[model samples]
Target: MADTEVQFMDPLASHSVVPSGQQKQVRGEREPDRTESLQNTGQGEVEELLLSSSAVVAQAPPCGDRAACSCLGARWMERSLESMELQLQLLTSKADDLHNWVASGQDHFEREALAEAVSRFLYNCQPYFNHLEYLRSHKSQHTLLPLDSYTWLVDFSQQLCDRLEQLVLTYASYNLLCLDETKPNSVSPFCMGQSQLGPLRVAAFRYFKPMPYLAQVHTGLYKRMRWNVARLREEQREEGKNERVGDTEYYFLCYEDIPNADAGGDGNAVRTWSIGKWVQVTPGTDDIYDWIMCEVPQADYRRLLFLGSDEPSSSSATVRLQQMLSSHQTAE
Candidate 1:
């Protein structure tokens, strides 16, 4: 499995978080205040709200035998096989829309306009994240897409982001001992890394939505701890030498809910991803001036994040995402 071919996927595209066991941790400290959400609005609550079942109650025992674990996993895979096909169909339809939108007219003109179009399309699509009215409180939908699935998608992101933020606060409390806690403990500094990274979480399952398509994305955060360009490259390079790479090495969970293909290409086969959130497929995704001038509600994504390396500019990143997504559609 270590030598399994890596599919071309967007780190920002919607995806699965790393598995619970294999996840790598960034900090070993503790922070309580940040964990309030996890205490109140935790995975158990979220699962109950969505699955109408408690993950604790539903969780299977760690089988005594690997063959047994594999057997159970295989059964789960068989059940999801059909859902995966449905997800594939939805992807094709969305890709078709993108192609037509581009080919329809030169009139959509600005990247801003295209971004708006993408937003409109998503709203109509019923993206996830609808709030439950079981309690007396529920906030109105804010910056994320207005679609139902997109809403859940945002909720998914929000929950994970909140989890990570809490982790940061918690870890900040620790002197950096490397927390290795029980299930409830989660990896510190960023629990999302432990809870939401990896393709086993990412590529292995298909998303499902009962309202629209039979299946959608099955799979698929956070500030602070910024690293400078030269420093980051050097750090990452050093980590590589030691056979260590990105923490949690979990880029799949944050995959933008777009096609697996992006705008640029190294000519490898493209892999379609699950539903994504806040896609940066168009330029000006980070254009502060354009957003201000257009009167778009500033997303808390309001702050600019400069993740560009010498290899690609932020705009190129978006374009490359588009190209890769397009290529994936073609390949499919």
Candidate 2:
């Protein structure tokens, strides 16, 4: 497959290709339409939905120590929830808009434009998911920290959890649109597939471009992969410091087939890696100041990590698998 460029969706931008009249029609209110730009429409809807969603999150019972969780206060929770909820709203709205566009039917160019927009919108949500999981795990551990220091922790986590649920729903809707034959222009980076090795879902990582390698991994296999960490230290470099950073280790979450030992040893099996799980690997070190490591449980479908090279370099990533295979050879 050719390399695909990952586009970032600027929630704050006001650009939209939809005709002005259609934009007004979608808003459904006359009053001269305050949100003149489609970007604004997306941003505005996100803001409104996030506020409503945050209220729902706030009402839910608190998870960590309320005293230590400063962000959980009614007002602060609402404020902190803005960024995440806005992104979720923007993506979902984009999906909805694209669906309507397909339903209305359009020229080939218009369909291509809509497909690109959907791809970008869906890809951008991954980082927010990673950041949210990092926040949740850290806040849960810092129950002793004073509220003033991390005022937004509790609220951030709560709103993140809520928005994540919304993301799953929105992703499903978007995927369906891709699969819908009626919407001749629908497209996505992922597809549903199953085989004897087990069900496997794949996503291409733009940062690790052109990683054209493939292998079948069996279940119960543990492997560690390493990749060079990119760093920018102009100030340190100016002061005679080396800017190069060493590679770090992260475990790969591979999908394996599980035999149906429960079915009277019939030898039937199923794959266990749940879809829609958050799956990015990040390694933090004492040298890195802003790094956030996540400790979310791997067992939950929501916490599931994705396999996309799972590291920066394709060749280096295969080292662990090589070791596993070599060991197996010796044992045999």
Candidate 3:
């Protein structure tokens, strides 16, 4: 969706050419030269290969509708998704280890060591291009995270990208496009004036994983994109049950800017968005980051995105969101 274009190389362009001198010709009998015959055969083979590859590429539709995609494309997608699943398992294991360590009442030195281990894992687990591409295409599918556990990996990696600052713009642009695509009655703000942010931005903002608890989220529900609302609150309740034991359901607020109807103008304007709290909130800590509270209508979700300008802090966003929730409960 980003204006950036990717040029793909022809799969058969680098086919090996057999040397002309490698083929020998018989001395007599008026038979066709062996070398010529071999060359002709090779040329025909190359043409066939090229034609096959081109046909696959030409016929392949967007991955969103994988059921109708070419067999070759579907195979690649399956491979990519399988690889991602393996990688996700590794990440989840690492996060669980970290949580267990915290729960064990380790000393300060031990805690530091675990933190360092997490840093190493995060760096090593950075997704490959194929994995990222699959994620890009499979954004709307609920099949990826069937159980909705350990989705914080995406958020954690996204937060790391924000701190690194490299490739931020590229990610941002992609995220903007994805956000629009997922939104209901979505508007194309990037075309009107929004700048592109690349993959990191896209991952941090647009990517949605299912909540770890029961009950479906209403916003963007038609697209089958789940947020962490139900499970986040569930985690909050669980946190209260066991104070000392370290569990993974820590919560933090995150805010993103999205397109909204302009009050007095024809053009789209940015709106602040605070979904449910981000995962991995520190134990025994209250109100660590800034946030605000608000209710997002399912019908308007297409216009909503995860990245934008002039957003409020987590605390501010949390407060606003709380107010909205309370008011909505009262109205109901």
Candidate 4:
């Protein structure tokens, strides 16, 4: 204590006099880093949380009440059915108009108009037919609809099919329609003729094998023609035997190419064959002929064959035809 001047040191003074950089380092040490804290929380946990949220959202229904959702669905279906019914009614009216027009024996121009209208009707009806077919294939959906509604839809579709088929045949009977292979789907009169020639011939050929003929000088020349004529004659004779008037008739349109036969044999020659009678042949060019098979056969076997072959066998339309036939049978 001799001459010390009573000097006193504070311990906290040294701690408070730290450099700015050192102060920052000391504070950083005391506080945890945000990045490090997040790192400590595992990525798996974050992903699990996101997944759980998504699951909750997915599990939630469109409506809070189950019955409410069902009611909404039923209402939508009812509206769809109503709209479909309207379409059916409109188409039926058009079909009736077409029937009247055909019965009137209108001129060529009128026939052309009717043919275009028919093509359009068939094209338009395809969507509805497809929808009905969908309902038919899916039992659950079909059952969900009201019984009366489903029945009515099926019945209307069948009736529409019958009407359209008849109209096409009636139009073809005029022999005014010609085939233009280039435009199969065109609404023109030429393409409309396809509705009669294409499906019916394909169905008939597939169902009934070509009949055999005796060997002749021009065997290969008229092979198809001979077979077609023979089959048609046989079918017509069978129908006549039962004393039932046949609904279908076959007409051959040909152009002869003989070196010296009746001066080129009327390029647009058309001949209608009678029951059990063979078509007259000039023996010029047998393959240069087109057949117009008019009116659908009324027999069940023939009808089913025609329906099944209305489209390509592998097509959805064929399936629809089968379903329609099945439904028709059930109804009957």
Candidate 5:
């Protein structure tokens, strides 16, 4: 495939195309605009809030005794909670704005604006997760930290995941629309299977350039949250706790062509959509960051569809077969 250029124009400047392959080389040129966007949107506000919260935690009355330490921890928890609530309010407003923009009729320029908005929101969410992880790590020190705070954090993380999923679906929908708009009348190699292309395939083709970057950002956020949740689950299991602390599930839509399950003479490839759930099998190992998407059962897929969900599920048999084939590939 030919290289695609993703260009974002400043309202004050002329049109310029930034080649995706050469983005790093042109980073300096793009930095100014990104910095400007951050400033306009109050980008570092979350980090500032978190820093102030940490300051409060640090300035807690000297822990000269057990009672004093406990009191200090209680103060820290209260300050952290207050800071998190304020950060959540800020993020929720940004999320709402992004949703409104997506709902409205957007042209190319508006689409760029949407992408910028998403990038900014994701940037803010990163620090929020980091702060949450920090708090989790120090849970032992802060005896006053309520169990309910952990639950609230998990729910809030899932809420952010929901928003990211919506963004993915919106981009995929636009990709499909772009494909239709750019389709050719001639039956060339590039156009042969255009109509049959799924959202994943369309995204792979970079039909809409921002789709790939945004999808990647979405994946990174999901992986970080999943990793944290996996650790929580492991701790619960080790302690023999029946009540699960953070039970969060994330899935991505996938499409594949597979042979018919029915007994037939000429087996043909049938196009199907499937949901692949993201799993972090090794939380503390060298591969801790290596997350995989395992195909879910057909029943779950049907249930999701019945519930009016945008993502479709995958065929487990097909996915397994693909994995087996992949395992045998020779290393370069």
Candidate 6:
């Protein structure tokens, strides 16, 4: 038998498309406007009627009894309800995406802009995590002590809970880089009282550059900490200081395991680290604030410790994540 060749439809057009299958629009479906022309017109516009040969609007068949009409009406209502439900579901999905976008700083702020600039990010989901708060922010050295620790503790907690929700920074899993003060920024550095501006007050300021490399985390189980020199601010409070020092001297927040750990490196999974001032340039203004160790805070460790201990305690292998950008907070 002679071989006959049949040309196949183009694959891009005929073979590949969504749903792995395609059906042409139902051929009998009447064009709305065109059908409007041929079907009926009760109004004023001058127009022509056009009708599709294959499509003729179907009318309800004549019914002899009232029961048939009622049944038909009910079926119509049910179909309309189903269609409305589908529309509502689509709208709901769009609304949810919008809400998440707003939380991610996408609605009012550009995504790249938000990522580039550092500011306080507030998360409403605070109650779920222990010692974490909604008011989380990236702080600078110009910030003071009390605010730094309080905010960092809370911010660290929020980030921990959001480990699963960090939509942007995806590579570093289960790793957090908290700001440790190689040299702590302190109030005492500017020892002189407010003098020049009405009294002997020194002006203070802080600066921070974007740190992308810090995101390269090595392990997934815990957070490791590193510190740089802490810079002092320019302002000198009215509060007098005992010593005279430069405005930007670096102070240190000394840390060891909390509850005083044994000399050996191996210890419990969740550990508490104590923070203390390495050096105190105390005058009217104290230079050093309380220390923050990589070890989990005392109260928070208790909280995480409570979780896996349902049966009056067995053991746990996970440690709480803690880290923050160095920010100088006001004494208050």
Winning candidate number (lDDT): 5
Where model 1 places Cα greater than 4 Å from the true spot, the runs are: 1-47, 53-152, 176-326, 329-332
User: How big is the positional error of residue 240 in model 6, measured in Å on the Cα after superposition?
Assistant: 12
Instruction: List, residue by residue over 260-314, the lDDT tens digit for candidate 2.
Output: 7788888777654311222232323233332433322122113234444223232
Order the candidate numbers by lDDT, best to worst.
5, 2, 4, 3, 1, 6
Candidate 6 local lDDT, 1-332, one digit each (tens) = 00011112211122122121111232344556633321222111111010110011122224455667555544433333333233223323323433344354342223222221111011111111211111121112212223434443433433332332332232111111122212222111110001121222221111121121112232112111111222223443334332343432221121122332454656543343221111222222322332222221111111112222121100011112112112122221
Q: Taking the tens digit of each residue's C-alpha lDDT, what string does model 5 give over 217-282?
A: 232111110011111345554553434233333333334445666738476655544334444332
- Give the winner by TM-score: 5
In angstroms, what RMSD does candidate 3 have relative to the true structure?
A: 24.9
Report the C-alpha lDDT of model 4 over 4-40, residue by residue, as the tens digit: 0111112112211322211111112322453232222
Candidate 1 has an lDDT of 0.27
Candidate 1, 1-332: lDDT as tens digits: 01121232222223223333333332334434532221222223222223321121134334466667655544433333233223323433443544344444433223223333332222222111111111001112122212243233234334433332333333223322223222233232221111101111111111111111101223213211211111123544444332223322111112222333554554444322222223222234446665556432212112222332222321223223333434554776
- The positional error of residue 69 in candidate 1, measured at the CA in angstroms, is 38
* lDDT of every model, 2 decimals: 0.27, 0.35, 0.32, 0.35, 0.39, 0.23
The per-candidate count of clashes, in order, stands at 56, 3, 36, 0, 5, 33
Clash count (model 1, backbone only): 56
Q: How does each model score on TM-score?
A: 0.23, 0.37, 0.28, 0.36, 0.43, 0.19
Off by over 4 Å in 6: 1-99, 102-110, 117-270, 279-332
Using lDDT as the measure, name the better of candidate 4 and candidate 5. 5
> How many Å off is the CA of 51 in candidate 1?
3.5
